[model samples]
Target: MHENIDPAICPVCGGDNGCALLAGQPIEQCWCMRTRIPKEVLSAIPAERRGKACVCQACAAGSAPARPD
Candidate 1:
């Protein structure tokens, strides 16, 4: 996504879900529903932003590494 894209973009990869659910499909059909996002990785997000955005595929799938401190 370009600048001025979703601020809710993943803090890890700065990307969006682009999933069917996000496109107005059922939650059960969303890929994230089947995926397991690591708790430690989720903890890296700032408290204020927690639960505010969905981490992209890479972060959710553990492909992308932790963001530097």
Candidate 2:
């Protein structure tokens, strides 16, 4: 799956200064290869935009794990 994203823009935060994990990359080569993103944060993304988008480190880091209610 290839995410036709702006090379350096974050969809959630709208920041355009760094690289997001492009869609069609090998899992091992993807930018998200190292850090672990929270499932809650991933799910919060709108359905139509999931997998087709990539979040920046700042944004990912900002999404602290959700607490149980």
Candidate 3:
């Protein structure tokens, strides 16, 4: 596993993943539980980060990469 992996962050874009489960909410309450994260989008995340953190909605929806900030 990658060091310092934060489940609250997006593994792909390094942004806030907004995972309800990470926020102490039920797993069923997480948006990811209801949404279908595309295979291509999931493939974008680095191997070290995959499954370590949640991908953000934008990344999961294939609408974002690294955001300008």
Best by lDDT: 3
Candidate 3 regions exceeding 4 Å error are 67-69
Give residue 36's lDDT in candidate 1 (0 to 100).
84
lDDT by residue for model 1 (12-67), tens: 66666556655788978877788888997787776655666777778877787665
Residue-wise C-alpha lDDT for candidate 3, range 1-69, written one tens digit per residue: 338878888888888999898789999999989999888888888888777888999998888766343
Q: Return the lDDT, model 3, position 52.
A: 84
Residue pairs in collision within model 3: none
lDDT string, candidate 2, 1-69, tens digits = 864555455555545424433445566765667878777566665565565556666667874333222
Sort every candidate by TM-score, greatest first: 3, 1, 2
Q: List the residue pairs that clash in candidate 2.
A: none
Worst 10 residues of 1 by lDDT: 1-10
* Top candidate by TM-score: 3
Model 1 deviation from the true structure expressed as Cα RMSD, one decimal place:
4.6
Q: Is candidate 1 or candidate 2 better by TM-score?
A: 1
How accurate locally is residue 63 in candidate 3, as Cα lDDT from 0 to 100? 80
